[model samples]
Target: DKKGKYTVLSEKLTSEPMGIGFKKGDKELEESVQKALDDMQKDGTLSKLSIKWFGTDEYKK
Candidate 1:
């Protein structure tokens, strides 16, 4: 049996992509984080995590 429910507030509202904010001039850390995220996406770990946490892989389309 299912127990979850949801409603749409606005059809025009789309899912916005989120980002990690870093301090100014923190290029090295930002680049490293970006590389790690890219690697995770390439290896399917990101999708897996999304589904595990959000019930759906929202990152994929």
Candidate 2:
């Protein structure tokens, strides 16, 4: 289910979410980032970027 060079070998043992960090109360920054992410998902840019960077979008599972 992956296009990367590595093998899965076994089922995923843990979950690790990734994202940007900001100051404790940066609502403006949060809003802007959330908007960009939404726009990308809406336009299919997120899928393309995910494939390019992670080699597969099956991680969406």
Candidate 3:
């Protein structure tokens, strides 16, 4: 509170992106994952899943 009075505060949370970590020599797995993601996006599955999980389709980025 400012001046001993009630005050409303608002702020945006900063965070980093999280992803799956893999061991060395996992190029094939990485490529597969990329392909799967691409397919999902092309087929609208990704957006549907995002809406289902996040309550909004904010995964286009």
lDDT of each: 0.81, 0.77, 0.75
Query: Model 2: per-residue lDDT, tens digit, 1-61?
Result: 6579786544545568777998989999999999999888888888888777666673363
For candidate 3, the lDDT comes to 0.75
Best by TM-score: 1
Q: Each model's TM-score?
A: 0.69, 0.65, 0.64
Candidate 2, lDDT over the whole model: 0.77
The Cα RMSD in angstroms, rounded to one decimal, for candidate 1 relative to the true structure is 5.6
Poorest stretch of ten by lDDT in candidate 3: 7-16
lDDT per residue, candidate 1, 1-61, as tens digits?
4456765343335567778999999999999999999999988999999877666776684
Q: What overall lDDT, based on C-alpha atoms, would model 1 receive against the true structure?
A: 0.81
In the range 2-60, model 3's lDDT, one tens digit per residue, is: 68687433432444665877678899998899899889998889899977765666567
- Note each model's CA RMSD in angstroms: 5.6, 6.5, 8.3
Superposed model 2: Cα runs more than 4 Å off: 1-15, 58-61
Highest lDDT against the true fold, candidate: 1
Residue 50 displacement (Å), model 1? 0.5
Name the lDDT value of residue 11 in candidate 3.
36
Tell me the TM-score of model 1. 0.69
